[model samples]
Target: MGFEQLAALKDQLAKQAEEKRMAKRAQHAKPAQNAKPAKQAEAPKQAKPGRAAPTAARHAQAQKAPAQKSKPVDPVVLSIGKLQKRFPKAFPKNPAPKVPLKVGIFKDLLEHSEELGLNEAALRDAIKVWCWGSRYWACVAENAMRVDLNGQDAGQVLPAEAARARGLQAKRQKTKNAAAQGGAAQQAGADQQGSAVQQDAVVSQDGSAAQQDGTAQEERAVQQDVAAQQNSTAEQDVVAQHDDGASQQDTPAQQGNVA
Candidate 1:
């Protein structure tokens, strides 16, 4: 072959090869371009919320849930518990029975508060709670002996103090009974209101039923009247048919007689 023809043939083959590569690349790229926009369209619009970060908020309460969560301990109660351990005789635990204490025992407790790691206010509150219980009042009879921290007798219970203790005990009991009665009365009132609502509902239902029954009776009466009217019309039609037949028979008889 001639050199010119050979060069032209080589150029044509190269152009064809380049076109095939471009076509294959475009085919591979088309699906990717279409899929990218589709994926963007399917994406969610709503913003994702952050996991709970603590903010200052406090509110609701319930009954049994309180038992599940621990409550803050009272400072006075903790102080009293410590004193009970140190001086078991003067501040005996429940079920063991309480003993009358010396009238000026607060002064004695104040002296020991520092060693026991108790503050003044908490210690004073503890002493008040310990002395104010029913068992302590029971032990405060006139002429009954008052004991020190070691259970040794220091003084006798005065008559005036004993009388005051009795008054306090009676007042506490009366208040407690009144509170219980109030709760019971509230519950009864709520029950009565519920019963009244139920009765009203029952009355409303019965009235609706009675109204429906009256309407049904009226419909039945109308149907009966229509049936009666139809029967009377049918009887009149039968009578007219009988009269026409008699007239035709009489005419035939007259013609026969005349002939």
Candidate 2:
């Protein structure tokens, strides 16, 4: 309970409190350092090789390409001078040929004048006076046929006569064919007769030639027999002469021995 003892206890308690506070601070600092190192390792894991950022460069290049379009063609133009130079005869419209009475709107004017209820003889006289051709007459005939004539008959009326003429022509053609057939038949008969005559003449000539050949062979055989008989007689005469010469030589030898 003295003052020295109390002061010593207070000093010991103060030193112990200071030592506990320093130990707590060192433990908290060690944990903070380890957390910093763990954070660094996680950063390296997140940023791996396969992880890359996306860019818009390819999309921008596609957008910048130009759009394609088809090209157009131009038309050709010719000058009037060129057209005129190419077609000189066609300039200022081509000149039309004169419409003759036979070809144009003026043919057959006379025959149909009665159908048209006009003075046909007088019209004929007028056409002759005007020196019109047959084409004008034809045109007038066609126009007259087209006219309304209150049921008047206007076609040609000679059909029976035309049919009679055709019948006569057919008859003439039939007669000509009959005559041609008769002539051909006669010619064939004459050719057959001529061939028969030629064949008979050839047979007669061949028979005469065979007879002549047989006679020639018989004559040659007779000549050979006569020549063989003459050769046998000559050979017999030669043998007789040789025998007479041998007898005369024997008589001469006997006479010499008697002398």
Candidate 3:
């Protein structure tokens, strides 16, 4: 083959190879553009209009959570605090009396001491034996205080009656008092009536005696009149008898003279 003919063939092969490489590069660039649009679409989906960012929302929720509470204080510590507040002078540092104090004082302390991990009886024993009647641990006998051994008040434990019962009792007492007063009044009235009756009886007796005396005086006056009448009649009869005797004597003297 001729040398010119070989050179023209080599040139044509080189042009075809260059054209194939340019076409491949254009195809790869189209795919890259499409990929960019797809990435933009995914970005809008991740960030919706009304939704918050995942990290930001999680951070906000964490901030809104409540904080954990601290541990509670011990009962002993609370009791000690209560005692200190109630009696600052007694428990300047801590309430530790040495001498045998009143049970009243111990009862007051016992109300708080139970929470200090010691009951009433246990605290009393501790104060008596552990403190040995020291001034720092005030201890007393069960019967040594103003209050009772049962931790009750020294004053009345139970009322005489409930409100309603007391009201009823008071009403009954009032009624009883009224009845007594009424009985006394009735007795006094009866006594007065008896005295009045006795006075009337005495007056009636006096009137009867006066009437009897008047009747006796009238009878005596009538008897005196009758006796005077009888005496006058007898005198008249004696005079008449004397006159008759004188007449008889005169008649005899006249007859003798006639003869």
Instruction: Name every residue pair that clashes in candidate 1.
Output: none
lDDT of 3 by residue, 139-160 (tens): 2222322233233345321232
Ranking by TM-score: 1, 3, 2
Candidates' lDDT values, in order? Answer: 0.67, 0.41, 0.47
What's model 2's lDDT at 218?
49
Using lDDT as the measure, which candidate wins? Answer: 1
- For candidate 2, lDDT tens digit of each residue in 1-259? 9999999999999999999999999999997888744444444434445644334556666689877776652211122122223323221112422111222112343344455444544443333322222222222322233211122233331344234324434444454555555455455545555554555555556677755664564455445444544544443344344445433543332222111
Number of the top TM-score candidate: 1
Model 1 scores what on Cα lDDT?
Answer: 0.67
- In candidate 3, position 121 carries an lDDT of 58
Report the Cα lDDT for candidate 3: 0.47
TM-score of 1: 0.50
What TM-score fits each model? 0.50, 0.21, 0.21
Query: Compared with the true structure, what per-residue lDDT tens digits does model 1 show for residues 1-259?
Result: 9999999999999999999999999999998988744444565554446533233112223332465657889887888889889999988887888888876677777889888898777776677667765787788888999888778898887787777668656655655555555455455545555554555555556687855664565455455545544554554455455445534543332222111
Clashes of each: 0, 15, 11
Mark the 10 consecutive residues where model 2 has the least summed lDDT: 97-106
